[model samples]
Target: MPEKVNGIVADAIRRVRTSSGVPLAFAGVVTGPTTLRLQHFVGQHVGALSGLSVDVGHGLGGKVVALNRLLAVDDYLRTPQITHRYNTLIEREGLRAVMAAPVIVDRSPVAVIYGAMHTPTPIGGRMLDALASEARAVEQEIVAARARMEHAAEGENEMRDRMTAAFARLRDLAGTVDDARIAEELEAITRVLIAGEEPAEEPTVELTGREQDVLSLAALGYPNARIAETLGITVHTVKGYMKDAMRKLGASSRLEAVVTARRSGLLP
Candidate 1:
């Protein structure tokens, strides 16, 4: 599990370096409850920082993970805020400025992404924002990967594929309807097809028929562009529906929204 997470974080670190134009960037995935092992580095002059074990509340990455927030220092070696646990490694790599962004999943920190400069410079808002955005992207990927893993582990891939196809066909049929009432009824029945049995307790949240349509496709692991194409809507409109569905489901990510809807008997 840690290795899979490290792979995802490593790819994300490379992207961060490219997008943020940072001189140095590294990432680590959680190896244990209180520890994260540094696994991947990009733009580093030396390998001193590689494979370093970081503990919660110990250093920049640790603090970011502990607090579940982004943190940066102009001069990491001379900073009083974070512990100098990796001062020698930082010095070996000639790192001065550093920022750490927590990759959180389901409200828990799963990884940390670090960006650094070789000289003493403040980690600006733009760089911090870019790193944070990448972290969120990583979080989404991790969640979706986990969902795939769980689905495979449960040996339901075959059933899932059939359900996904059936749902898509039903949605296509629903689209052909001229009457609003008939279309809505079709959507309601599609929801039943998604969730095998009606939930005993009703969910407090309510999503419009269109919101459910978008979210149902999302549940099948369809990306927004594909969902838009299939539903004959603009990508921007697809995003709007997804955003509204996530808000209504109290979810922070697309996978989370899908999971919540399934649990709420809104999707299968």
Candidate 2:
């Protein structure tokens, strides 16, 4: 069971106790797949609540635990359909009309709550709806917390991988580069990659390494014919590369593409 669900359960008990004037308010949490453990019990005597793990389909709580639904009984001592184990607590607390509601999450029952009174009265449908609403709110909080944790985990993993790859590159180039200037340049690249900066370029106009090469020349005031001649491609092919580059760079004109490339460090 999620921790947030417990808060909702405790709050629900308070709500029921306030509205119904019932002294006996208890919360039962499922310890395992088949065992419903009494988590919180409030009354004159809570001693009977100890070691109370009802197995599925065995005791009064077991029936409630097994059914995964709310239950009520006006006559606990004489309910032939239910077992007699919890009768002691019921009798001790002067509880007669015992109410139980199952806490459900992801279509599975994870916990159960019980409220009892010395006498019998029909537990209202609105109270039941309140119980269900509280349960759903807790489930939503649990799911949202899980999603945030998973997203953080993914970001941590990505940063770790990028740092590992950067170190490997530096290690490979260590012997060839003896100057401090080259080493400082490599460290700066490492910091930028670790920070998750997207090259200061618009993601809508993301560019390929080769496409960048083509655009830099275009930005340098070269015509398609001249660019194709210099780069060993036809004028039509040059136009195609420029089109793709412009789309990625978010540039409506040749001047904008060059500026975008320079800012992104692709041209520089």
Candidate 3:
């Protein structure tokens, strides 16, 4: 999970740098209830900021996490809103204009992404908007990853139950077998079934949390508008998620996507 989150944060900051032309882009994920560690970096010239830990309400990134909102400063060293605990580190990195957005999931901040410039050029609204959008995408991806993990756990339990039932059925059938050889074969099969042999691997299909959420609701015969209302998203966003899910599932329609998701253990 930590590696997956690092990948997501790396991709997000990379996109932020590419789209907004930020001279430096970096990110840190929440490692504990009060810890955020800078783990991913792009366009950085020095290692001063690498692996730096920011606690809640301590530094720029910390303030962002504490506030759960976007923050921008034309000169990070002189920003009154955030404490200057990382001044030496920021100075070594030569960062001036800095902005950060909280990657919030389920109303809690999970990570912080930042964009900065070498010169003290005021960060523009467009850049802030771009950062915010990427942060939202990160939030969605984290949610989806967590959902997939949960579904996988459930699938394990279901498999165990099915195996137990099959073993019982096999034992019952063995008792009725007239041929001694057949009975022995049945008993051997039952032993193999209960001996924890590796099951055949199934095809893997990945679905984002929002995509699964949209498909699961759609499976309940809800329209896009209703799904949006229920999930607190726009109808257009719901459709987009559904479309992406369908593409991943190789389904042409919502029903097919739902069916494929269930078969793939993406949906309950």
Candidate 4:
């Protein structure tokens, strides 16, 4: 997992543990294509869970990962919906009731967060909601982090392509030009390009808090009216913020602005 995702997961575990009144809250990030490794936790008696690997479709957490949804069991050891491969570990940890929510990104499970009770007590609806909310929050963070990385990779490729094109143009000009001094200058410019001098940086664009909020919602595929409803602002005000953000980003459309802002690390 990326550092950003790890940080978010850690914070989410703490928040879930406190807000949900769960004695144990732990997060397992996907360590392989079909495996989740318990990485972070809160609460005592969780030492046995450290570095535990939950395979997809095997344990309570694995069921969540396999199904990509929230799951709860009143008695984990007696749960029939999931396999009992991790029963030994669960028994060692003295956990009876368990709940798990999957952190999904792009419709795939990226991690699983679990909350458990030492006694066979059913988790409340509010606690379940809180755990699911934390999982969703982590999912959103992972999605944004992945988008930023992809955008950065695309930018690097674009820069390299532009540099290569410029170098070729300079070389072509140097070959066709008759003036030796101009040709030498062109060659010198090509040398500078080959040395990797970057182009002039674009002016930094700063968006206000509201502008950022609107754009972030837009990036998540929310319409202006929905964004307005979410932020408790008027649709007209949402449009205004979107317009301002688009102008600052030099984007010709809403999607363009969202892409640019995400690439610039202005949206999360």
Q: Which candidate is the best by TM-score?
A: 3
lDDT scores of the candidates, listed in order: 0.86, 0.66, 0.83, 0.81
TM-score of every candidate: 0.57, 0.56, 0.70, 0.66
Let me know the TM-score candidate 1 reaches against the reference structure. 0.57
- For candidate 3, the lDDT comes to 0.83
- Candidate 4, which ten residues in sequence have the lowest lDDT sum? 194-203
lDDT of 4 by residue, 64-141 (tens): 888788999999999788899988889999999999999888788778888989999878999999999999888888
lDDT of 1: 0.86
Q: Rank the candidates by TM-score, best first.
A: 3, 4, 1, 2
TM-score of decoy 3: 0.70
Candidate 3 lDDT tens digits, 1-268: 7788888889999999998889889999999889999988899668889999998998889998888999999999887888999999999989989999999887888889999999888889899999999999998998899899899999986775465455545655676779999999987876575345432324377776567567756776789998788777899999999989999889999988876765654554
Q: For candidate 4, give the lDDT of residue 242.
A: 89
Which pairs of residues clash in candidate 3, taking residues 3 or more apart in a chain or in different chains? 144-209
Query: What would you estimate as the lDDT of candidate 4?
Result: 0.81
Clashes of each: 0, 1, 1, 0
